[model samples]
Target: MLVVTTACNLDCAYCYEGGGNGQGEMMDLDTALRALDLVAASNQPFHVQLTGGEPLLAGELVFRILEYIRNNNLPATTAIQTNGVLLDHQTARRLHSFGTAVGVSVDGLPAIQEQLRGQGAATWKALAMLDSERVPFSVTTVLSSRNTRDLSTLGMALHSMPAASAIGLDLLVQKGSAAAKIGVQPPDAVTIRSGVTRLLATLDVLNAQRSRPLILRERQTVLKALGRDEARPYCQACTGSSLAVTPRGELYPCTQTLGDARFHLGTLDHPRLSGTALPDGRLPKREECAGCGLQGRCPGDCPSRLHYNGADGAGLVCALYRTICDYCLYKGEIPS
Candidate 1:
């Protein structure tokens, strides 16, 4: 995971990159290549995600970096997380050449999307360009109170888009720009669980009709619902095998800790690397979280948001997860 630049062309209200005033040092082509070389030397089945204030802003640079990775034979699969605002026909064609899987961060339809993501016309046009180019891309929705009510609308909108290969939903991480003013905060646990349940139901219908899979990221909920893998129900970011590098060439445990300097590891160009070197100091389960039956499955919610927003480790939004988990267990869907 690497954030190439802190700069973004759009000032989205819920921009999670806190320092992302869109004015940070951009990694030059050589810098990016050096990082890739370091990953290759480490002999790790690496995965790198290109993110930014907006990665597509560095379109040509991003393309060159991917080319360097392929040419060097790095054991890596690259993904780009873009706002889908800058993607045009030409750029989409270029991205397809690199064989990079694109994940577009779209919240919902024009009315809802513009409210949260802003730059409505641009994002819609970008999606159109992707569809026109037949570029295989996916949509990632940031589920929030504002968008929760419109989940079905969003699903339908994405379903209508032929180029979309998948749909993913992430609970709104209320921090940084997003927390400042979205007229709401991260929903209570009950709301998150209920909304996810609703969204998943809608997705089931969409998936049944289409060859493309609908991705609701309801793993924790669905897993709990089905009585499987309870303890590790949600995103086990650190426990999961993944690495992320920042634009400054520093490696971190994951992307959630990218902007923060404390999690910095050695630069990517160094000939020396250690698999066990990076720290995994994410919030440990508090007493409240530990006693809960769902604790075994949850990664304890979003650690970054908890750290940044001074949120209690146990939040109302998390209750929704617990509810879903318990429901699944009661139904004998998941193992006790």
Candidate 2:
């Protein structure tokens, strides 16, 4: 179940939903409840992420929706993706009571963070509140040229947070953000390699100190590093494994396609997808993967992002992904 609202208090440079300054519609509580009902009937133990231009911008609507889901016996793991700019003691307390795990987006330490994510003071306050409330949380940082230099610094910030359970290295996806509109591309192959190498080394240092391991590229990074034989998780966009519903109750496969009318799945209350099969169907045909020896494990790259970027065939990131996969596969992470 995806709840969407086009309201936010911060002007983060990397925001994908295009929400800030209250531009989208606001769904009523009844509509949100109906969506929950549909999810419960699907029999898919899916996560119900409360997302928005900023979900909290809808006032107590988030709490109410969570309460309804729990009370109705719907099976869901509730999560909230917040910039942490608007979080307060009272709000944090209510969210914690609902068992809604929080994932706060922070780019780096104060200097770089303020450049990437606004309302620095508020973000810090929210992190402190989460810590005081003992709320299990993860900090997400978007890597970029402007901030990539701060990977170790950001790691240090997270390492200092005893309340943080994990850190997600969100490599910037150049699409909707000002970065892309202004012609900013993702780091080149050389840069990706150097940045990832730096990130991995820094994480090792932090791990040596007993801090939680940072999660980047998730299964791909982990499996390859450990030399395991596990297949990489299919891209979220391709499988429709995830969906994003807008504030007006419109459904999208993922947040990346939220505003694109073509990707609309269905209304939130109805919670049924419309149109052709989602990109997920592209999987299972190993031979179609274009000479990718790791196709069995990597599936294909994220179809949603590919469609969004107007890319065809293998992607720029695919080459790097295969490199990681091959390194891991031969290294015994996957037990050939």
Candidate 3:
């Protein structure tokens, strides 16, 4: 993943890298090129997701990378993940020409959104611009303690947004300063199970009603995982699949590992891509899970959440994942 810049215009409470204090921190252009060259040299197909506090914050860098990819005919799929607040009409047009699929962040209506993103309606306007430009985009709603219970309401709201081609629900992993101060974290296991069920049912209604229905990533993900060849539950080990590039050209296993120097993979100029040495602390380590039949289907919980705040909160959500997995495995009740 190319982290163009760590600066974001919005003061979202759950920002993983704190906030715009990282405004000036940007990945050097040469570092970006080197990263791409290394990937292309492998002669393999891959995806380079441009992400940051907001990639659009560094529009020039984003454009340069896209142009380079096209000119070189790199065998890679490129996309950007942005907050959508700065995605103006012209910017949207430029991205469209580059064949970039945008994934924007949108929690809910103004009241709910402002709670985490501060007092602003810029995101709403950006969403409108995306629709006006007919930009192909999707929404990522970060579920927090504040909005978990009302996911069904959020589902209905997203359904009404023509710009949203899908909704990807992300449970907050309290890591950075901004995220830790979000006031409420994710709810307990039982509550999450109930809330997600409601959200899934609401999506079912939308799928039945709309001709080009927005996709439910949660539902789709669960379905795909269940059908996979792995007999055990799978946790997307961040180090194995991808790495996040820092502004200084430093590499880390994932964005969640930012600020923690322990996981540094080395620099782009002197690259050392370590995929196998990541510690178990970065994964679910509950000893009791060893003999459980469900271990293959639902590991413990997200490691990012477990050690985020210098606390072990993974058990809270681990129980939740277990409950949901049980229903899916035994009851045959998929997320949708």
TM-score of each: 0.81, 0.82, 0.85
lDDT tens digits, residues 198-269, model 3? 776787778687767878765555555456444332334433656778888888767778767777778877
lDDT of 2 at 247: 62
What are the lDDT scores of the predictions, listed in order? 0.67, 0.64, 0.71
- Global fold similarity of model 1 (TM-score): 0.81
Note the residue pairs that clash in candidate 2: 226-333, 227-332, 227-333, 227-334, 228-333, 228-334, 229-334, 238-280
lDDT of 2 by residue, 215-277 (tens): 544434546534434454445555456666666778777776776767777776565665523
Worst 10 residues of 1 by lDDT: 272-281
* Model 2, TM vs. native: 0.82
Best by lDDT: 3
What's the C-alpha lDDT at position 218 in model 1? 51
Candidate 2: stretches off by over 4 Å: 183-185, 211-214, 217-237, 268-277, 281-296, 310-316, 319-336
lDDT of 2: 0.64
